[model samples]
Target: MNDLELGVIGNCAVAALIDRDARVLWYCLPRFDGDPVFHALLGAPKDASDDGVFAIELEDHVHSWQSYVENTAVLQTELHGKQGSLRITDFAPRLFWRERLFYPQAIVRRLTPISGSPRIRIRLRPRFDYGASAPIRTYGSHHIRYVGPSATIRLTTNAPIDFIRDETFFNLRAPIDLILGPDETLQEGVVETAGRLEERTTDYWRNWTHRLAIPFEFQDAVIRAAVTLKLCTYEPTGAIVAALTTSIPEGPGTQRNWDYRFCWLRDSYFVVRALNRLSAVRKMENYFRWLMNVVASLHETDIQPVYGIGLESALVERTVPGLPGYRGMGPVRVGNQAYEHSQHDNCGNVILGVAQMFVDRRLLSPPGHEDFLRLEELGRKALQLYDKPDAGMWEYRTRASIHTTSSLMCWAAADRLARIAGHIGETQRAGEWRSHADRMKQVILERSWSHKRQSFVESFDGEFLDAGVLLMTEVGFIDPHDPRMAATVKQLEKVLGRGPHMMRYEAADDFGMPGTAFNTCSFWRIDALARMGRVEEAREYFEEMLKLRNRLGLMSEDVDPKTGEMWGNYPQTYSLVGIVNCAMRLTRSWESVT
Candidate 1:
């Protein structure tokens, strides 16, 4: 399926999903949360088709191969036919120009013939209002403008405008450049401008990648994951989205799809941590600003689980009626309603993210006393809410449990705050924070343990085993060598682990059974095994999980255990974070590589 065979190109401003054959299947304009200009990834049905897709299809398509330019977001797709072969180099213009970051909300698709003549057709179908209406088209000598209900998109190309407008086939004569961007007239010729931008963009990315501190093993995979994480960041606000796409189902024909094009405190925390390991501190600095603004915007101490990339608090989830779901699955959702849920893990996550600013002396400006004081507000909230029942990390709507993971994060928050207070010379405050952490840990240790289940249950006094508890050792809730932690890991593996994959939890949520295994949960198990001195087993498991990644070494949020098909949103940050974290923990010393 084209959905599985996709590569992404972006410039931290906007992104597009292009299939193996160099077709722009899905792209939102202006920003990640903006209207879908090319929405064909979510096909209409078997009977009809959706507009807003850009594709250059060869008459007799034989084979295709796609890959990213090394250490860059640029993608190259090669298509072959009996007649001839063609290559399309795609990228969004992002480079240092005039001593400033020049990132435009545009996609550059440069098509060149490699062999003999090939017949090709250009289909530039753009819709507006989330595929609700088709755009009205008008063309000139070298440009075409599609005016939609809300915004207009212009396509400037060196190719014949008549052939493109009429969707007619033409023989490959020379290289053509198509610059699809905001509704603006191009002053320069297409080929010349695009050629310069491509070279500059390539240079810019290579320079950025050169600065990363990657592990010895899995260097290529780590670099790709790092670049993908950079693309997910919204440079304007420094808010990193959970994923680029809105609603790709977690499982086939299951209504478990949810919009992920928003900032989640928990998810961003892991993202910042992963980037920190790579020494990509610029993203952490930008995300710190985004986090501070989110904290400032909240009226109460209760922070929502998720927010819009622009820090818009009211992310009321709703279904868009027009466009069919990914693979025609239905009920395509836009905004996520998880914002309304009170996930107690949020405050702890924010503190954990902020704690880095205080401790990391390598940062340009290490956090001071004032920053610590600001974080104390969240620490207090975590101390108060950790034991109370809420939606938990999974964002369950039907039932609320005093989730052990939530309680454990509460302890982590208080513990970090206590340390931060000590760093700022607030000994009295440090002691108080430590007291709160100790109290929360006591309650969790006493209440979350189940005698009959022989493990730490999902929630207080419950028999359900959640894969989330597999993080107990990683999060410092318990020592990896502790019997209780070992039992919890073994029990979770029995309940949630299917081969190498692990489910977040087997218990039914607002939906029914989860169709696929959560990607990060399995990685946590690997980390736990390494910490517990099971290094060889952890390495074996880690390698198996790595093999499940797509050809581009990218992963989605979930994977069907039965089949290796990836599900959920494309190139999810959580899945990528797992790759980086596992690689770091499992890699040998840098001295060996040296």
Candidate 2:
């Protein structure tokens, strides 16, 4: 079966997922939202084998192991056979050159035989435009080019071009270098370029890891998660994609698949917050600039739930009929229509991400008066929409309700703006923002609380339970010690919790009941439990959640509560953030080790 124990290798420009046996199964070109150069991950059920895959196969393969080179996006897979053993090192070249980041839309694969003669076959079948067409190939003495409708990629390698073109096996006598990238030919020799990039990329990542303030416990896991998050970020525009691939269903046959290639304001807020915990705020600072551009672009328009990485506003979602979905699940999709939905909490999330600039002394360009004025515009929108009806964070398709989580975030926006105002010594503006926040809080307390249900409800004056409101404590909407919060947690778990996993909610919407538990909701539950002094229980539950991760310590958007099968998009940013946040919360302090 196709699995997500897949290792990811990429620069911020583009990424690809390689399976345990060193097959490039999924990759988007030029940018995160670009067309799939490799579509094997979404291969049809009938074609179970590598249909559109780029793989290096060892003859009579017996044993295989895969891992990242320490603190780097480079992936190493060791394959052993009875005759010999070889190592495959894969990475997308990203390193500092001439005092700037040199991240290209390229992949570098180096094959080295570590033992006796190991023969291997090269299968490079790249599909284009979502597997709708095959590339027309042409070759030179040292390179082969695949030209498709949308893009063209060149394979520059030291290996025999005829052998690679014909998909034949050859003996591994010496090191072979394959650089798949833009159609242009490289000036330097293939071996020299690959060697230089591998060395510099290693240094770049190790330097980055050295600067992070990771906790002593689970340092490897934390670093891996952090690296994955960084790989998801599109550095050109400072937009971080939720995941590299789209149409990986939330659960099997649930039809809960949605495209996550675009940036959601709400998700970005959590991403920056989690990275900030590790003292990695460079991405956050760049993201702040991006958010500023996004907010400025919407001079009069209301903020949407998601936007294109380049801040393109219109994302009319549609299914790609040509490609079967992941594991032959149909309805492969692209372009999320949630961009058109009215997710009122969006303004609050944008403001929250931007508010970080005013306080972090490390930032070179902190928020000035004009920045505060622009934020006040978002604050006004939050206050205007807090009590209004629209889709909540889950982006329910069929209905609209006064979601309590939306209101709480609006309260957060106002609360933070007020604090920001005070920090700038704008006492009058501070008081005004505070008054708005207070009013929103009072209304939320009055409407969302359910005395009959003995808990806070999902929506205003509705008794439905939602896992989102369990974040009341984490977001500072309510103290964990408060009886109402405790009651809400208890009732939420009763309704949504299955073992250690928690469903986002219980109600049906555009789809039927969710088949898998939303991973981040459970992590939020862990945080809430920790804040409520259920540390022992929280630790036990955290361990349970950890078991749900794949062998690589990676998670998807959701997991089957019964089968523990990972579902939804692979290496989801929200899921990764959950891992980092929960680890930081539950791990013993560094001083304890001292």
Candidate 3:
């Protein structure tokens, strides 16, 4: 029996990283956020004989390789056997309607054989809702239906397939020709193939990607990074999720797992900044509108650090049992409880993003004029808590403290409010805000800095270096070339820096165990260096940071330098924004130097 390792069975979706032997190693389906239907990536199933898992086992296959089409989302995997070669292409069609109005659509996988006569096998096992539900599969002439509570998966195969109760198995020889279409038509409860779905999907990406006017240097990498960022966005809410999947371990079995499929206020701001650099205003404008909506709906004291795709205010975290985690990192969790915590930087982040839009793009009058009122209201709330203790940028679940970074953000919020108020002719309010901002700046400089250490501390009472200090320059709190700013950067590099990246801060009782170095902070260091005229150092560090991107030019929340594996969440939005910002900064620097 030839065991092909490249078979992927996702919850109602089929995906795989095909090997030379035509075996699949990684795949999840139905929705990118859905649970594993075939979970071999985590661990082997208890009952391997059941068809409920999709995998390929072929022995004699020689070589395999995988690649994505340039500047596109299509993934292609190829396998070479003694007799011939086989290729598989995978992509999800971009739907016409927005996510709120339409059900999640289909994922298309196409297989073609190019060489000698070799036998191939295919299996599909689907577990729904984080592998908590097992769907019942019913076979048809051209399709197979897997039905479970309120959700239905229909698979259409161009070639013949052998059907089992909850799985589908099939075999093909070299010169194989087959098209696999898996649709998750949950609300509608029916799946149909349109005459021009593929054509439209290809066209959608081609047109969308072409809008990015990127420099020729590293053009391919830049486009892929841009596309990856787009995939992480929740179209309906204009909220970009931090990543596609959660619970992928930072280390082998460390409990550092956290859910990342929700929108973070901080990440949203960076997303806007990144998109703004590309002159892609529609998405950023939509997000700004979403932010305005959030601010409008929130009570004075009920603003959260994060929200869901539907703008749900509550996020109760829960861990799933029975199913093991990715790479044996147990206790996979869904829903983030951090929503209840106070992240002081969030309001400041929002202010900074909007201010950047106004200053850089001249978007003084966004489409919905009412959004300015919402922003003003939110700024007022943030001002009220300027002196209060709360969670800082890193959501340490404990009693609030006057985190230095938080205080800095408060200053940022005040500064932006002053500018915005001035722009809108709120002369009296603008004056008050500016006065308040000056006071906050004075407070941060006085209380947050540690004279003995000659650097800013993490909290008012602590004497530790925080990676967040890198932002002092980025946020314009201090000039990058200032001796004080230079000293702080030196302190962070000496204390928190791990190789090329920097840790958030030293581990403390308030925050959980500090794990790997954060990727965003690493880029922030590059940004700081660039702003300080350390152009060569910034360029070198930026290139080193790019090495952390996965095969798909995607980045995670953190990384284990020793192993080079992604830690924390996969494809973090903040990380991508860092990449975009760093690239743009480097390009700008080059233009200036020339």
Best by TM-score: 2
lDDT of 1 by residue, 1-594 (tens): 426668989999999999888889889987998888898877643333746689988879999988988888899999899899899999999998889998999999999999989899998888777777777898889999999888888999999999998899999878999999988887678888899999999998999999999998989889999999999999999999999887799998988888999999999999999999999998988998888887776556468889899989988888888777887787789999899898888888888887878777777766667777778888878878888999999999888989988888888899999988887789999999999988888889989999998899889999888888876787788889999988888888888888888899868888888979999999988888899999998999899999888888889999888887899998899999999999999999868765
In order of lDDT, best first, we have 2, 1, 3
Question: In lDDT terms, which candidate is top?
Answer: 2
Q: lDDT tens digits, residues 1-594, model 3?
A: 111222221211222333333334334554444455555444444444242354443235787776766656666777676666667666665645554222244555566666665445666665665566677777776567877675666766655645333234333452222233344332321222432444555666777788886754556667777777777666656776666666766555677677776778888788777877777776676676677777777664577888875677777899877567765567787788889998888878877767755544556445333655677776776677766788888887766678888878878888888888787777998998899888888878888788887898887766877888788887888888888888888888888877788778875634355667789999999999899899889888888898877655777777876666677766677888888888888865345654
Q: Candidate 1: which stretches are off by over 4 Å? A: 45-50, 590-594
TM-score of each: 0.97, 0.98, 0.87
Superposed by TM-score, candidate 1 places the C-alpha of residue 60 at a distance from the truth, in angstroms, of 1.2
- Model 1 lDDT at residue 56: 85
Q: Which residue window of length 10 is worst by lDDT in model 3?
A: 1-10
Tens digits of lDDT, candidate 2, 1-594: 337778999899999999899999888887889888787888832333455789999999998998888888889999999889899999999999988999999999999999999999989988777777778999999999999997899999999998998898899999999999999889899999999999999999999989999977878888999999999899999998888888999988878778899999998999999999999999898898788888887786878889899999998889888777887776888899898899888888888787778988998777689988888888888888999999999998889999999998999999999999999899999999999998999999999999988898889999888899977787788889899888888998888989999999878878887878999999999999999999999989988988888777788899889988899998899999988998899899778876
Instruction: Report the C-alpha displacement of residue 266, candidate 2, in angstroms.
Output: 0.6
Task: Indicate the worst ten consecutive residues by lDDT in candidate 2.
Answer: 43-52
Find the 10 residues in a row with the least total lDDT in model 1: 43-52
TM-score of 1: 0.97
Clashing pairs in 1: 52-125
lDDT against the true structure, each candidate: 0.88, 0.88, 0.67
